[model samples]
Target: MYPRVILKETLYKKSQQKRRTSPCNYKERIFMLNTQDLTYFEHRPRKRPTQKGCIELSHIKCVEIVRSDAPIPCDYKYPFQIAHDSYYLYVFAPDNDCRLKWVRALKEATQCNNLFMKYHPNFWGEGKWRCCHQTDKLATGCSEYYPNGAKPLPPTPDPKCRFLDLEERIVVALRNFHPEEDTDLPLHKDEEYVVVDSSEPNWWTVRDKNGNVGSVPCIYVAEKISNDIEKFEWYNKDMTRTEAEELLMRENKDGGFMVRDSRHAGVYTVSIFTRASCIYRSDGEKYPLVKHYQIKETEGENIKYYLAEKYVFSSIPELIRYHQHNSAGLITRLRHCVSRNVQNSSRIKELSSEKWEIHPDELILSEELGSGQFGLVWKGYWHEQQVAVKTVREGFMSEEEFKEEAHIMMKLSHTKLVQLYGVVTQRSPMYLVFEFMENGCLTDFLRDKKGCLSQEVLQGMCLDVSEGMAYLESSNFIHRDLAARNCLVSNDHVVKISDFGMTRFVLDDQYTSSYGTKFPVRWSSPEVIRFGKYSSKSDVWSFGVFMWEVYSEGRVPYDNRSNSEVVEALNAKLRLLLRPRLCPQSVYDLMQWSWKEKPEDRPSFALLLHKLACLHQDP
Candidate 1:
């Protein structure tokens, strides 16, 4: 029987990338998606289309937007990716509607097959995965993926963003508001005004085109974004290097870029992506480099800004405009502008803003996930997804402590870390909402799946925790309590570090009378055991114990010893965790390295991360 046609269109496809090569260029192809298979053919005008490839629907696992800011080389700007077997096929559509139509059709057609639970939201470029920076092509996805393509509850709407009033420096009065007092500005509908000061929560200081200035209600004016620097999609005032790469890679456009403020005051930085770089990673993939050029200015009467130094322009905008059309000594020309909205930056902002104040009514607590020293954890459903709800026990933490930890959690975001969904602060007992983990704690997971799991999986679990710790170390933060029980396992078996905020809470059994604070004796480093010292190295020592738990299939460190006894063993530097049964020699060696008596001698979590990434189970 002939294949039933579902959708067919000519599109731009990213040619397949081979190992150690620069990013492949885009080529026009005629794509046809049908019941049995999806195929693409080389399209040439006035000639028969030559079939290029075919993918069985069963082998297809993921179909989603290639959220990227890299400039598209093709006329069709909107891009999507297909993950089939071991390959990823990226294609572009004329517009967002066309892109979504194809994505939805493909998803509906392949609903019955095995699909990924998590997928990288950005493209794999240079030598690493853009979103997570994982080098392996088959690395576990960093973002949750939905088979039904469900989106998170739309972040509570911002009243300030209504009718295009979103971040506009200049706005038009929506309707007439006559001045009631001399201080108030009289507004006329559709009359233009520049917002001079918006520091007042509800009011703004504005200057009319005629230079008349006074206070006005923020609600009376709406943004007219057709002109202005903030109006340009490329301008991102708060972007950092990491944020810039995330934005550009999410766009998946080769020349995607943004103009952000430099670290220095009064200077702008142009951050752009180039598919190929001069350097290559250990994986032999050409490093996909995100290049940031500080817009430099000449010391002259007619000041000019330049990125290449040789290519100077009259103004910053003129320089940007010139570089858009010319590579001119840089890696790539700035081809497409990706705004922060595409980055969902506002949602990131909201995590720390008033929007973080989740209504107590929205949460529906069901089965208990676990009970801990801090409080009870319940498996709950919010906005159609399972979540873990942690209730802060009364007297467990002070209002000051809770606020401090909440602030820390809000700042931490990583694939290996359990995400803090939101917090409930209005009620008696404070609550923290987190992303749900299906397999519970790593301690329990290793216990249950002990013999069934391979050495690779065990190592991966360690890698996950190490990655999280590495991030903590880099952030100048410390996870004082790092242990198997403090990590959670997702449904796909990806491990994530959790309960990081619980280090402040006192665990009854883990407390030492001399220390005046509670820290798990078995996992505690020598310094922590003696001086109650907690640093990233101390966390690394704890990580050694955690690794021992993983390879030993959840066997407790110092299982036979008491807290006092374990402290003595650590204090003397005579005893350390023994190699778990069947643990790789290299891994065990690294574990020992992490447990060095001197904190300075212990390898940093960042170094440990590199060591773990380099290891493989003996063939």
Candidate 2:
């Protein structure tokens, strides 16, 4: 393969040496790309081409279309660059298609080489970079560089070791999903399956337990290492330390035990209730203490576990069997295994394929919670759990319209954002099921609490909303209707961002509204109110006013001002709301930072979250 030709073309070329002192004149050249090397020859009229330079393909680190605005003194103006061995060679083509063809072919030819993770899109010219204006020639690229320009394939499984690595290779379904198309495979919650191919980021080809193979969404399943214990009576996988203690205390039974996942990932702890009848508190009540023991694992060829080093068992069940008959080193022998579902508050699987789109007949409505811009909000029940239902008022929006909102809502999941359980779109008057917020909307909660709220509480609300907004920003979602009225308050006073009325998932972080698209004028950034431009940073501007609402005890921004007046005020590039009375200067400064005139000047939601978190640590 030494001299096998891959591509042969005549093109205009610039100096191969990247140094500022190198020759700058453009000249015609005959370029030949072979399996082993790329060789360019000096153009000679009706004579043998004289070889000018040769570069091994292995030396090529980058091949891409260069972003440039320099005057081209050649017939071909479409330029692409090849970065090899600390130097760049610019080759000009007659058209963009020709430039892209060379760039793509070169990229494919060098796909397997060790490559750079970052690159400057603009040309590094005149002893400076055009993209970021860095003086250093070897400075890190201002943009992310994706090697191979494609999703990586999962390592192929070796036939001999496939079954031997079952625990690590097999993924168990977290929820049920019926096939929506020919490509999709039906998934049953908790069933294990083997991944056949994971070349697609969201969808993976998998083989189920019954040998049924098909494509499934990668998010629907996860690898569960110790799946054998999932069906055990004593296992409760999703409870916290406090939750375990509460469960054991409620039972009021000594020696009652439950094995739960530890706070530290991939670890387990055993909690047991042991009581001393004579040990009484000063208030004359018997004391109950739940002893927690971390199950220690020993490193060896075969993994083993034990509460005490002396009595080790290969499995947790075996250890439970031993401790059941004898105390050994425990405070008491394990007895009366506590189940998770005894109380209705047990953890519900967050998302599953079958749970997202609910049948309207299954929802049970009781009392009216409230009403909003979309429709009437009602307290509803589904799967025996209380949820808030937001109905789409007839004529307000159709099933197709509501489905777009639901699709965006389903992809998002964060503690601070109001959780969307599912939707009912198959019938008339489509509705959405969301986690109920007992304390109601944030605006109402702020008004009701007013002077009774502490500084910590106000700050906590800001942090919670910022955290949710940060998640949305990272997820490339812009909550165009972000406001205090749109946020909800949980029973524990946890503030969660809600009402994604104008939400859009943008890959490029920018979205333009249609001619008649509606948005909150009072809370929108300048670009949005004027040009109808929206981005995550635009959402940050809305959050500044949201923070103002919390600090001002729910006072509306530009009180008594009309929507047109608010737009005019934003157009004038002035603050719409002043600092709240008794608000911290540092916090007020951050609010102003979020309300910058340009969206790019405003901080990201992630950065806002950091600033608020830092303020949380403030006195």
| Runs off by more than 4 Å, candidate 1 | 1-353, 502-515, 617-619
Give each model's whole-structure lDDT. Answer: 0.73, 0.74
Per-candidate Cα RMSD to the true structure, in Å, reads 21.2, 23.7
lDDT of 2 at 202: 43
* Per-model TM-score versus the true fold: 0.47, 0.46
Span of 10 residues, lowest total lDDT, candidate 2? 344-353
**Model 2 stretches astray by more than 4 angstroms:** 1-354
Please name the candidate that would achieve the greatest lDDT relative to the true structure. Answer: 2
Write one digit per residue (lDDT tens) for candidate 1, span 1-619: 8989999998888766742111135678899999999999997789998999999999999998776433343467788889999988888898877888898899998888899988886777656786767999999897666766664322122346422224548777757877533446789986789877664434567888878877686656655534246655568988888888887877666667789988898888899876745468898866667888888889969676788776765556656655654456777656666677644211222233454577788989999877965789999988878999988787455443466467657656666788887888777577888999999988888888879999988887887788778766755567778889889999888899888664321211121222134568888888776766566777888898888889999998888888888877776775555678869888999888887778789897767776675564221
Please give, for residues 1-619, the per-residue lDDT of candidate 2 as tens digits: 2578888898888774533211235668888888788899997789999998888889988887765433343467678878788877888887766776777778888888877777886777646776666998788786555555542233343454232223336777767877633335789986778978654334567887787777786667755555367776678988899999999898776677889999898889999987742257899887878889998889988788899897776667666655654455677666557767543222122222334778778999988988877799999899899999998787565333365577667666556778898987666567789999999988998899889998878988898888778767766678888899999998878899888866765546777663334587878888887867788988899899888888999998988788888877777887845689847888899999999887779998767776776677553
